[model samples]
Target: MRSVIIATENLGKFREIKTLLADEFDVFHSLRDFEEKVPVDEDSMLYIENAMKKARKVGDRFGMYAIADDSGLEVEALGGRPGVRSSRYGRSDDERIERLLSELEGVPWEKREAVFRAYLAFYLPEKQRCYVFYGELKGIIGFERKGVGGFGFDPVFYVPEWNRYLAEMTLEEKNVLSHRGRAIRAFKDFHNVRFFRNPTVHRL
Candidate 1:
């Protein structure tokens, strides 16, 4: 099987990506399988830049194909704040949730609209080419946190049309509407149509 390195330390993300690409490539997490701790400075102002930097860093180091994703929640009321800093929005996850909740306090539910944005970067060292895929999920923020399934802002992100928090939905349900899932699906389709034609190269 051909191997691909997924540049991320988040276990939930790793699991999702592994499941998404299982049939097509052998996926390995940098932190778990390789014990790599090199931090890719995400100082880039844009999501694409950050994702590409991580993917390129891993691909260059291992001389293998690499994939990286940078995602975050963008609250319309907050002027897209806590975007790139989604993970570290506050001291801890709880703190982050608190901060978000506080920010939305007194705001109307309709004005509390938000969207999750994901940018996926793929790097092919041998080909010296980089590709990017993006996805967005639109939903409104709930008055209180709900569910306990997903990590990050899942509990606080509510889809009124679905009448449930993101964390409350099953993986299958989330995969169809979540930003990360949509990005992965687009990436897979791109790979299948654009890069997977040649069987000479092994996939990982």
Candidate 2:
């Protein structure tokens, strides 16, 4: 059985990635499982850079494969105000939502175009290689927070394809259309193929 680490302390994300990779991996571990935290500052301007930095740093520290991701909500009207700063915009989730709504208060529905973007990075220490995948869900920002199903900016992110706020969707539904899901699926597919010939290496 091979052990791989998910480079995040976030329980929500840890569970999602565990479920996504459960059937394929023998053992799963998150950064929270370790005694000492790996210090990897997510100060990068781009999501990919942050994701890669976290994964690579963790993998190097433990000599184990690591999976990490960076995601955020980008509003067209704000000129991508909270791209990499989605989690750092406000002190708390409620405060963040309030600030977002305040910023988009005068923006019309048509001008409220927004996108939820995610970038996933996988680091393999033995090979010193990294794989990256990207996904984005396009939609408009809702006038008010609508659902309670997801975390972060789910309540305020509207999905045109589903005709509702992401918070309104079920976990199964969100896993099918959300940015993280898309990125995970892409990485999963690539990993399945990439590891088809290499039996010992497990894909993160």
Candidate with best lDDT: 2
Per-residue lDDT value at 81 in model 2: 78
Error of 1 at 108 (Å): 1.3
TM-score per prediction, in order, is 0.90, 0.91
Residue 68, model 1, lDDT:
91
Q: Which residues of candidate 2, in runs, are more than 4 Å off?
A: 192-204
Candidate 1 local lDDT, 1-204, one digit each (tens): 688988887888887777778877854655567765667799977888888888888888888889899999999999997898888798777789899999989999879999999998888999867788888898988888899887788999998778899999987788878888888888877755556422121111
* lDDT for 125 (candidate 1): 90
Error of 1 at 14 (Å): 1.0
TM-score of 2: 0.91
Clashing residue pair totals per candidate (backbone < 3 A): 7, 0
